[model samples]
Target: MTDLLETLIENREMVQPNHANMLEVAHGGNVMKWMDEVGAMSAMRFSGETCVTAQVNRMDFERPIPVGDTAYITAYVYDAGTSSVKVRLITEREDLRTREREKTTESYFVYVAIDDENRPTTVPKLTVDSETGERLRQDALEGEIDGNSDKS
Candidate 1:
């Protein structure tokens, strides 16, 4: 079993001119790419094997990350099956000067562990033993529920 907290991965990238779109905000594609990278890292950490993206459930870009601000990407493996790991990803816009942050995107990514032959491989179960781990998992679950409810 792997602790859910152990699978958490956080990364930040400063939005440069090249990474921005016409409006001078980080491009959607760039944000998705960053999310994928961090999500894969979280899955690999939990599985102890190379992981490849299987699906991206949803990506809601609620706000823009302006150039010169920091884009913080956070990911963690919240659940896993025989060979699949589900990760929750959240992207936030942070002003380095003031250390203020606001969420800009949220998504769930699924990854499958692979062996040397590129075949799907089994992964250990995810465990949420600590209070913080449980809270994180619960929060992700609630977010998913809230997102889905809004569609109706």
Candidate 2:
């Protein structure tokens, strides 16, 4: 079984003027788009199949990234179901000139594997094989716990 964190993926996007809204910061839509892309990548890496976004649990914009900064997006599979992979999307802002990083946003996204016919397909079971993988699994468990708590 492949561990979720073993599928860690990272990508960076320069926040261009067009990516900003009226606030001169990266627009929410742009952030969402980046998150979706990274989340899908993580799912694809884990499932070894094409994956599509099924849902986004919640996206919280904890901070803003300016147009001149670089958006660093990181994603890793957190959990899996019969046909879905859960991933966490973390976005950070790095000052390109100064090399400083600050978290910008985070979200939980779920993706489903699809076959050639676009039908949902099963994914491989996940295993926590290393210390970091174990920690990521625990973090995913905490997210589950938080979700359950939010229901009540």
Q: Which 10 consecutive residues of model 1 have the lowest summed lDDT?
A: 143-152
lDDT of 2 by residue, 22-80 (tens): 99999999989988998898899899999999998878787899999989998888789
Assess each prediction's global lDDT (C-alpha) against the native. Answer: 0.92, 0.85
RMSD of each: 2.5, 3.3
Query: What is the per-residue lDDT of model 1 for residues 16-126, given as tens digits with 9 covering 90 to 100?
Result: 999999999999999999999999999999999999999998899989999999999999998899999999999999999999999898998999999999999999989
Model 2 residue runs over 4 Å out of place are 147-152
Instruction: Give the per-residue Cα lDDT of candidate 1 at 1.
Output: 91
